[model samples]
Target: MPTPNKPDFQPVLIVAGPTASGKSALALDMANTFDGVVINADSMQVYKELRVLSARPDDGELARAPHRLYGVLSGAEACSAGKWREMAMAEIAECHAKGKLPIITGGTGMYLNALTAGIAPIPDVPMRIRETVTAELAEMGHVAFFDKLKRDDPETAAKLDGNNTQRMIRAAEVFAHTGRGLASWHNEPVLTPPENMFFKKLCYMPPRDILYDRCNRRFDLMIAQGALDEVRDLIALNLPPTAPVMKAVGVRELSSYLSGTTDLETARDLSQRETRRYAKRQLTWFRHQMTDKEIIDTQYSESLADKLRHDINQFLLTTPK
Candidate 1:
């Protein structure tokens, strides 16, 4: 049955799950039944050039309702929670103005968290400082980075990996901006429960074995659908190796195949393995970080929609705006 809208409230519904776990389908079904806008929250699907590999919704699916923020970012630029938050906040404001429910769906936990609790301001590092850090990291290895961060902030150093250059740079940027470590900056109080908005957050997790099967099958399907060709075209641009999109899992594997470092089948297997690892990480994040949210175990599918409908209906007439 279709939902009947209430004028007094517009709740933001966020559906999150691991990749290829029917999040897009569920969001589409909700959009069809309710006057809602489907907003993309996945990190990779935002890139304009990555539609095929990112598993973005197809034209037929998008035609069902208004969708926003998909395929908007250029492939070269680094897209992060900060930029996503800026775009999402604007879209949310517009959705509210138009009196439509906003359904933010994705596998990216950081993006969803940024939507509710505003991200701690992130700033760009000075070019000189960044290059110097990168050079030092290259020459001395993570040991050098670890030593620097340890001297700078023992707490952040304790929690971080020396090999994670992006995170290391981010901590440095935070320190450079706020004169404190990223840990200290995060200590600042966050005023959340965003204005005039309430959310019913749900994470859809099927069993581990089933989820792994789906991941492998979906990745194979992606390869068959010209994901390799997509990467071929993307690499034709000859963007810097450090360009943001090149770092994505499948892209690197595809590049190895293109470079003759690995056979296509080997590359595909490697990609699938990495994707499974990523899904495992996402599952862990869902369990630990969102322990309080209502989680649907769609392992067997017998209770899937009943649980889904019950959860949605529970929020419909009762959750405060």
Candidate 2:
């Protein structure tokens, strides 16, 4: 059932989950039924060269309703969480201007977190500083680098997992560049929507074994759908090694096979394993960060829509404009 449109109200709906968890299907259904616009929140989906590997909406899916932000960026451009949040806010405003509900759907936890909690405006470190920090971390090893971070930016280090080398390096670099802790910058005023705004967030977590099966099946389908050719074209572009899309899930594994470093079987196995591991991390992040939101184990079932409709309707009715 569609929620009755009240004159002053604009809805923001967030559907988040692990990859291959059927988040897109549910978001499409909601967009069709509620006269909503589906907006991309997945970080990788923004890259134009990765349509097949990213599992972006197909022509048929786009024909069902309006979609925004997917495939809007080049592979050479890195889409950070803060940049994505800014783009999303603009999209949400446009949706409201058209009196359409905005439904953000993706598996990227940082993007979702930035939207809901507001992103900290960290200053950019100079290229030299960034390179210096990167080199130091590599030379000293992750353990020593993480220990140094704990000493210099204990507040930021306390919140980060020691194994998250990328973020740990970022925090260390911030301290090195500015002599200010990254966590302290996070305490500054955040850029977010007005105080009256609200978001109805939902997290989909299918059963572990079932979700793993879906991930494997989805990768197989992606291969059949010409993901290898997509990667080949992407590789021909010869983007930098540090390019964000180069690290996209299937890219490395498939590229190895294409380069004759591995067989198709090995590539497929490695991709599937990495995808399952990513899903596991997503599940953990959502479990810890989104404990207050509704958690649904869809198990790739269509039956969840009716309940979703009811929940959305209630949220629309009760949440003030």
Encode model 1's per-residue lDDT on 1-321: one tens digit a residue.
223355546578888888877788888777776678999999889988888878999999989999999999887666778778888878877887786778899988988887776676655344445555556667877777678778888888788877788888777656655578888767766535466577888788888888889889988999888898899999998766655677666999988998899999999899989988998999999888763477867653536756666777778667653
The regions of model 1 sitting more than 4 angstroms off are 1-10, 124-132, 139-166, 175-184, 299-303
Q: Identify the leading candidate in terms of lDDT.
A: 2
Tens digits of lDDT, candidate 2, 229-295: 9999999998765567899999999999999999999999999999999999999999998746889
Location of the lowest summed lDDT over 10 successive residues in candidate 1? 1-10
For model 1 the local lDDT of residue 81 reads: 81
How does each model score on lDDT? 0.78, 0.87
Candidate 2 structure, TM-score to reference: 0.85
